[model samples]
Target chain A: MMAADEQQLILRVKEGDHEAYRVLVGRHMKHAYNIAYGFLIDHDDAEDIAQESFVRIYESIQSFRGEASFNTWLYRIVTNLSLNKLRQRKNTNHRITNLPHQSAMNIISPPDDTSYQDVKPIIERALHALPTLQRAVVILRHLNGLSTKQVSEILRCSEGTIKTHLHRGMKKMKTQLTEIKDEVI
Target chain B: MSAHKQIQSQFYDYIQGGLKSDEHSIIDTHLASCTMCRCKLEELKRFIESPVFSPELPSDKLPPEYWNNFALEVEQKIRTYEIEKREYSLSLWDWLNSLFIFHKRQIIAVSSALTIVCMAITGWLLYVPTLVDEKIALPEISSSQFMEIDQKVGEYLHKSKTLLVGISNLDLEEKSPIDVTAEKKASRNLVQEARYLKNQPLDIRSARLIGDLERIQIELATIKDDAAIPRIEMLREGIHRGNLLFKIRMAESMYEMPRLMNVNNIYSGDRK
Candidate 1:
């Protein structure tokens, strides 16, 4: 979204324009949900956090300084809140164990012209096993197609740290996929 | 550079698509010359370029209902925020009107009293110095003349006191036992008083008095043959140091009061 348009929408939302806020949420909901899902690895929790993040954004829209891009700032908030939820879940020993598993044959098999359902579970599991920072780096780099510098700014880290995480994360994914090959097949 | 280092550097550049023509030429030459580096580079390239599957776009699988539901939820949240903002603004307006109706008379009375106090203070500041001068005439001394006279008087007093002590060295300690004892007792009393004052809030008046008593105690100890001299000197030095520190603290306190007062004044002015 053009920054000028987003700023205009934010101003309207602050002035109690529901339509303007709706437009903003409609534009950003998928991105926000994807980011939350990348961290929490559960659809329901991701959806809840994504919704909560929008509500928070609405509440604090007045305080948004235009120094950083609105999308970048929103991503930061969503990712941090998702990570906090993950930490809380871990502390409570609420293991998220409902992820649907599929056999290797089922994943690699042609299924009525559907390619996504077969691979999504494995990919999600691989992404969930990554360290938090590494997962964020991978999602930002591959899924969002953000530059390394942009990822560093959103994560509030140095570019060197982003590069290190990306390299280590990719290597780890390669190793994990090799280990999972037998089970999947 | 070592083959590994050269290859690693090139790999990052190649992955980022930032290799210049010259660097590309170098890499090509290396690839032709070194089989091991070339093989490693090929593996890295293949890994980077390989496609990994991901979830397909939801818009393709799901009907328009999915997006409509999401849009409706967003619209509902926005409406809630709008209602909250409207209610807040209305409450704020009601609060301001109520304040004006309830406190108008009190505010006027306070303002009048404040104006009268300010005028009285201004008049007093203008006239008090003249009134004091008229009531009590005082002598004036130039700075240079005062210093010269003080130095002369101090020298004369010091010489006379030394000469008198020397002449009275005839069992002086025994002849004036009462006076000596009174002086010793007074010194001990001053020390105790200083210790007590040290424990209290260190203000300018207390600190000054403590400094003066400590200086006198130090001088007397230097001239006397009492065992308490060393102990008294230590105490005296401690009190003097404490007074110096207290002086800094007193200045900071004085400065801070004005700062706080200025802030309060600004806030009150804004309220008015």
Candidate 2:
């Protein structure tokens, strides 16, 4: 029954129902952006990948049988595109810049709370310090709040592998935070 | 220190409720009894549940307006892409139409002659095959032969299913406990049978199944005891993507005995 509704939405999108497409995009846009952002660590690049992912979805919605859920399909696209962007960056010999520290400080509220601003960059730095797979596991499992099973499905690994990556990633992040805290104190 | 090490290794999984029931209970009992471990768990919790970690957005949410424009921007880009594609196709047609404008009659005449020549060649090719087909007679196999072939094919399908199930059910987390020698030998045996069966005059579906089966059997036959996790995962993915086990079962039940006995159609290579 859920599948029937999903198919109906897809069919409406295929039929050029603009409102239906909008609804579909609205439902997943934040997640798609955040997941991409988690990978790219740059807002503009994340937004580009997210929009491109949706466009690709719209173009190919005709071929999408309800085999995987729409969320899975969208995430797979987002993940692949983000990975491609990373690969392209590597091939071009460009260093992956750290998260935009000043930009982060500007957006985190309440703007007067200096401590919150200081800690945000530390968290972002610790997140970026982990290896790519571990970071991806962290973002998807913790930040995105996807279940371990869903993360495994999206990442195409066994659930055991996902759990291991999550465990390692969290441990590393905690270590980084503590080390930094001790240094500051 | 040793005891704490064992329990502490599980602290993250414990906090996440990712432990199995027995493990969870073990952690629970230990935490209740050990004040030091309880403090450790509290510290871990405070660290994880810190406000820095719980923000809905990883960094910060963009102003609401940025999100409001996001969907519209995607739709507009799609429209632009569609328009560009249509215009590109239109330009290609215009180019072709322009090329044909000058020598229209000559082009038409040449095209007509080419079509007629192609048709004559195709008709001759189609006619020549029938003449050769009329002289060839397909030898009839007796019922006994059909039954023997069916039995062999059925056994092959069942064995293939068993092998795949074993590989699929392997507990990957266990440290290399696979009976690789036994699996490799079974695959080798299947490969030998598959090669012999591929030459049989079977229906198209059965033949295709044999072909796919042979490919995977060869993959299995090559697996070493020290095969890497990625290699094992690749094999698993191949089986899953092809849906091979289910197809083998279907061929076993539906195509083996009764379908093989329909000798005339089977001999003619009829496809379902």
Candidate 3:
């Protein structure tokens, strides 16, 4: 049902129908919100950035070119804007400090369910310690399920560079998890 | 390769999808055969699939009013652009009015005055050419006289060649004929000079001459028998031909130097 609605919405929006724009905003809001949240890690900031991204998309509709799927382009814009905002916040020295080291055990696991609840916060703390660009690469590669080529296009970098970042990021995360495991033992 | 290094390299390639089908099959077979590698691959696959963090869904949902505020901001910016466009159009109209509407009489007066001045300048230009044609004259010279002058220049060049050959023979007689170091140095210099001359544009006649001279120099430098006087004489003839070619190319370069200098000046000016 959502796929059919999305196709219809895209056709209508391409024809310059304002009503179609509204439908698109409604349909994609959750996905856009999730991407923004992934980077900013703050609900309010994510919502604001997602809304602004939609507005910019509407104004620049003529510039879409349609070389990539609409969802890919929209997500790329939201991710870039969220990362830029994060960079600005870091520069202003207004970043949040002294947050507790969230463990990964709290995340819901698909297979073991029981182990997930204890590991989620640990995973989150380990992710936060990763360098920002590497963290972004990992999230886009794994969580978003984007191929290396797609991630490279969205990140405006070579596919090789993206692979290197992913490799290093995963290695670092593995090391961090091992350290956490030692502590637990 | 050692087993550990081979496994590490294969694991890296497998993860990257860079291995060929044959190599991939080899790795797969090894994994199936080896329990340790199979376990490592499984652990890596599970770790990558695991989530980094889990966040609670947002609770303070934005009311529909927020979107309305965003739409209003966009509308205001668009309206401002429209107003600026109108002001720009008005300024352009005022400038056109000053140039054409208010100054129509001045424009007509200037046009008639310019036409009379142009007619007077055209008459003077037409009359001056015939006057100069009648007064100026050019001298006549015969083609045979020009040819004689060219032959004299050739004779002078031939005399210079003979003088150069005499000087070279005297130098060779004075020096130790079998000194390997001197012969090597001379050959090296000849090679360097030949290479430099090759880079320059040479006529067919001159190029063949230089080629012959280079062959002579090479042979003379390599001579192991002092008794080879006939071979040395033949090499001398080759050297003379080569020297003649070099002289011809040098003369042509001298003629082109001024034009080359002008091009250099223009290039330097562009850099500045």
The number of the candidate with the highest lDDT is 2
What docking tier does model 2 reach?
Answer: incorrect
Q: Candidate 2's error at B179, in angstroms?
A: 60
lDDT of 1 by residue, B1-272 (tens): 46655455455445666557887777778778888877766765675565543323323333456656876875577568789899999999999788778999987898899999999999999899998897555535566764544343333223222222322332333433222333343344445555554553444663564556545544443444444445444544554565544443444343232222222221122321
Flag clash pairs in model 2. none
Write the residue-wise lDDT of candidate 3 on B1-272 in tens digits: 45643654355447657667997888888887888878766766666555533333322133456545544543455456557778899889988778777889887788789998998899989999887876443323366754543443333223333333532463345435533334434554555565555554444655555565556556755766564455556656665655654574465343332322222221122321
Q: Which tens-of-lDDT digit does each residue in A9-126 have in candidate 2?
A: 8889988897888888988899999999887777778889999999999999989877778988899899889989978988998665544445532653455767656676667778
What's model 3's interface RMSD, roughly to a tenth of an angstrom? 8.3
Per-residue error for A102 in candidate 2, Å, reads 4.5
lDDT of each: 0.63, 0.78, 0.60
Cα lDDT over the full model 3: 0.60
Of candidate 2 chain B, the 10-residue stretch with the lowest lDDT total is B263-272
Q: DockQ score for model 3, please?
A: 0.15
How much RMSD separates candidate 2 from the native structure?
A: 20.2
Worst 10 residues of 2 chain A by lDDT: A96-105
